[model samples]
Target: MNKLLLGIILGLLAGVVAAIAIPRHHDTASANATATPSGRPAAPHDQVVRLGKPETATQGSATLRPVGAATIEATAHDPHGGPDWAVRVYRGERVLTPRMRQQGTDGVIGHLKCAQLGRIHDGRFGWLDARGTFRPTPPQWGTSSVVCSTPNAAAPLIGTLSPITDPDASAARVRSTIVWGMAGPDARTVRIKVSNISATTQRATPHHAFLMALPARFGQHDVHVGVVYNNGHTASGPANTDRITLVARAPDPNGGLPYGLVTAPSIVPGGAARGETCLFGGGVRVVGDRAGAVDYRRDVLSELEVNGGGGCGSDAQALRKMTCLPGIASGTGDTASEGGDTGGTGRVARRTQRSRTTITMRCAPGVDRVTLQTPRDVRTLVLSPTAHAALAVYDGQFTTGGIRWTAHFQDGHTKSGAVPDVGF
Candidate 1:
């Protein structure tokens, strides 16, 4: 009886051991089946994972949250709902996403970036408004700081002249003030050169203001003001010139004063040498018989209107005398006048004369272009290395009343001169 009982106990113990081992083996197999290829446990299904890095972008009052690396999922919010009411993503100045309207809300979600977003620098999202105005946002993720320094370029120089006060057309004098924009920091010194067809004056100041007492003369009186900055840089202001007209005042019948017009000497014979014309007066003559001449008459009606005729009767007589005088004649060759009737009523018949004039120009060492300006049209000519060219001048009823020349140099410098006569 004792042996049988011992055997029975051993059998029960073996059965219990087998059962425990079998269950342990099955549990190991189940765990192995769920494990990754690298033998690590699989991640949870709803776990949050970051792929690469985070970035931020801010512009105006709006700021964007960090972006996801694998996809473009970001939020942009404005505390004050700035003027830029549209949101978009950008890689520098280039747009990365289509513009979306952000209305009735302070924040917007942008679906912008892609897997390659990591390749961009200072990548950011920005905002725009209906007016096509853009506001940039700071980079949310960048290798360097998102803020960039402002450009240090210089601003253009501009100038304005104060209204003339107490203008005395008879005395040929006027007072005015000229104000120019402040020079940039790069300017070592600021200087201005004021010039007209007849005279030129220069003044330098630490500030940008200049006062002047101008002497009004006849003809198209234009004052050219140019500024010189440091490093030999120069710029010219807009063409703002004053036109002066001198009307002949009739002599006092009672002999109170001499009754004569003060014609500029240069316009008259034996005044200045050839190539010099009376810029202040309306007289131009070319010396030498070879120089052709063209008859040019000033628009008397326009002049009368501008000067408010001293006295209709005397001014009319003066105008008649002016018409009788020979008009501007070009000095190219023989003189011939193509005659035509002035466009006027039969009662006041005026003769129109036309003549051909030849103009020869010699360019400065580096002049690349030359522009000829006449009252009727402007002609521009490109100069070759020879720097010599000739232009034809026609004097007619519909021709440019006056002539001017401008030369543009290779170094970006420009010089201008008034064409005194037909020949240059």
Candidate 2:
């Protein structure tokens, strides 16, 4: 995916070339020209809305029962009754989904923030309804992670289990997160154990889900929440929580942030330069030692609304932030009013758009793939295993909007999110 951050870089690199096309008249038009290529009308913008009558999706009647004795509540919603859905823990009649508001020149504004717990297609499947007063306890454990394929029987079955980052929490200081999950029938309680050399245990039965926040110190692979169930007789089986490990808190300090939540050219290597940009292809090029730097090179061209207008390109040699290249390249913009293009000519300017833009990106850790959903096509980029942290070359475009991405973990789980791109 072309990083949404490319907006800043693309503006710097976009090479402005006045393309003149002489028109030729054709006597015939084919029947296929009259029909839209996709055979469907352009769909309306998809956004969460409140219907007079709410329709919640069961997804095969899937249900989540709180595990342990921690009194958990679950409710699902699908206001439009289709692809988009959000599940919340509230029992109130008012259902709060995502909404968009429009500004005068800023364009339509709407955003849905999600910590995805499951993967579906090219995106995350678990998006819960957001909007509520701050609550710091169970039963009212308003913030949660849920995953369900087919609704399971109320009890004795675990449906969703994933990590949690409290809503609007700061990354600079790691706050205590919930160790919450679903309980199956005969599932009585859950006990969480953290171990490095010695083991300390915490239970979720009598003690509430939200007590005092735990200290923010974590290493790796040293935690598990055991939710054992009583058998119909005596023989019992352990379910998902055994394999699902979680830390009650995240690590705090330099470069401290939740796993997979780091967006960069952050954390400059010792003696390396601060993040900066230059022109690559008629797009901007971000140059950084450790930050997420993306190079936008336009290989394709289309009817652009605005001609290229940017400053000079980068002067630094690759990876050599201190050394200088003899020549620093710069760009020139069109500044004449009596030239070929006029005020009214923009509506039907002669343009050539058969080319493509190739985007090279350096992504942060935990990002398996970067995708750009351009108006023309979707560009998928898979980072090389060893060089993912250093550098990787990929191809994509930096058109207006569409910068969605997915992060893959060692356990084969995926989390999806979007980054906003500036047009530069």
Candidate 3:
């Protein structure tokens, strides 16, 4: 079972369902089987995965086109040695099977050459990009990536990296998808969710792509970009010479999966696939809102994008415990909420510098609204008194479950009270 061939077969099945749901268009969502936290098989197709349109298959100079909507369904075995896997693509009611090489009447699929782009950073799990947008047409969903296997690997081993001659494309890797759904005619907000159902953990990069036909000279200058979180505040980055790169630490060191990527063949202007060259001007500009910094670089010609600092094989587990604490502000110069602390846990004590001016406290479980105010220099007030006493911080959790507590600063001393604990 070659990954490319598997992709074609799965694409055909997905096309059938896609054609029905969206006659003029096709939609794709990736799904994975589930397993217990203790490493036991749960059920087939237990996890529902989705990939939004215009997602980036790999971070490289070559532009990757959108393939068909792909859905992966794997079934766990009783012995847990291996899982049954199947991939499906959606076009119209006409679901076609993946073709390795076209034969006879298979011209329709054969003409559409689906070149595998790259896998996600975690090995055995990646994505494929075929050519198509708006509505899928023949030759649109040609290229695909399928699962391959290797020894002691959690991520699916991806098949070969077509067009590009890279020896690393040895195995098939598991691939994940990002899904976005919105409500209302205005499309006010979209609920974006992602899942990793393979045997490995997949890192999801949140990105927004703008379609623009730049003048041939466009690559000459850098572009300043900013992204607005669900909150009204925004994080701005310097003019990026290439693309953006943002790295997030894994939740648990051992819980994350191993990922890798290799550049595929480049698509020339005349529709010919050629070996990729360094002359192309394409890269990324990664920014860290929490860290309040930015880093940019050229597109990865054939490199794996790993999270934090280590490769997927590296140990990500933290040597020290990371703590989440909530504090309140009462009598202070200025109390502002800085980014939460890291690498401290279990009644960890923290100190603020005098120049800090504003004292922001990280919150524990069940806390919300942190407040800091000044009595003498009202102008120096970080948070108004109205925002004081009632202020609290959240338990580090992205959503829900907060804590209550207070912070007071006097005699150049700061003390916090009533901090609760929420184990990670």
Candidate 4:
């Protein structure tokens, strides 16, 4: 079956979901299913495969309204590295989008772009305006770069651009929701803790959508997925806040590479379905488990995630080695609660040289405060109770000179060092 036709039980992440039916939470948590590839069958009418408001078949379920350009000024090189492309709205000035065409009953989703930019570089969805006025409404949910492209091909941008010839009409044909920031490499190392045992797999292509399985015994409350850093701090999403997806309810015997696995389209942790021009503050993440539950939450720790790279296929037997932690709680970072998508949680804002950049760090236990010093700014953040982390939103980027930082622990002990500029 088609992905849109497939029933998706989205947990409460806060957005308009559409499909054949809305899923319900159950104690079973699909106990009959596991994340491990089973080449399972299709889900029934009301099976709560993943956690969330199930996609519904009802018309008008998911709608798109174009939002304003996050930044008034923007610039980028042409794909061929030719002249800067036309489309001046990205240069500055508030430009209005074409009106969305109404189709009476069955009027649905569509794309939006600055009238001036036409079909080139700048375009976004989910900002409804009658004329040139920017009427501020609550942010639209599930906006991805489906339209925007890297060399014309990248992760799909669901609501941003158009396959439609007329902007007004595509807006009348909107169907489902969208998720963003899902850029990953050709291969990645995904680690999961199944009953306190740490297992790592580099078998995944890790793009668009994929699966990580845990044993059938695990529930939404028992899974966590995301990128685990070598420093022990993890950018993850917990199982609670409804971040579990079971294969039995939505099987994909031929998902990709390592067959039998399914792909859940655009998983926004905490259901960050809202829209923005450009977003920041979080990074991309993914994880694998056997229970058919993958936990991806908000970028709580504010770590940087690596993407735009991943392997082409997954090796089912590639689950190479296992490392056991003392206990579940023994792992640092992500304790419990909310989630994040590929990008950490932050409103859309274009990052400029002077724009504020968020700096975060995970400290050893007893660490109470962390401070950073850069040529342009100095920032300090106090760790929250039960949190071995610190966050500072300040100006300037980490440059070649590096930034000086210090981690202050409770015993008055201080560890200071210069964090080097980073790149992969």
TM-score for every candidate vs. truth?
0.18, 0.26, 0.17, 0.25
* Ranking 3 against 4 by TM-score, winner: 4
Off by more than 4 A, model 2: 1-171, 196-213, 219-221, 232-424
Model 3: per-residue Cα lDDT over 225-266, one tens digit each: 333444344433222222212222112111211111112223
C-alpha RMSD values across all candidates: 37.5, 25.4, 26.6, 24.5
lDDT of 1 by residue, 54-152 (tens): 333323433334343222222212222222111112222222223343555535433322111111212433322111222343344332112211123
- lDDT tens digits, residue span 1-424, model 2: 4786787577655533212243344343322222212132211111222211221332222222332232223222222232222222222111222232133332212221111121111232332221111111122113233322222233322222211221111121211122323343344554444543443332333211211112224211233445545553322112311211111111211111111111112122342233422212222211111111111110001111111111122322331332111111112211011111210111122232322233333333455554544444555556545323211111223455555555444456665555445441
Off by over 4 Å in 3: 1-210, 213-411
Candidate 1's C-alpha runs over 4 A off are 1-156, 162-179, 196-222, 240-424
State the C-alpha lDDT per candidate: 0.31, 0.26, 0.23, 0.28
How far in Å is the alpha carbon of 144 misplaced in model 1?
46
Best by lDDT: 1
Clash count list over all predictions: 23, 28, 73, 55
C-alpha displacement of 321 in model 3, angstroms?
A: 28
Candidate 3 global lDDT: 0.23
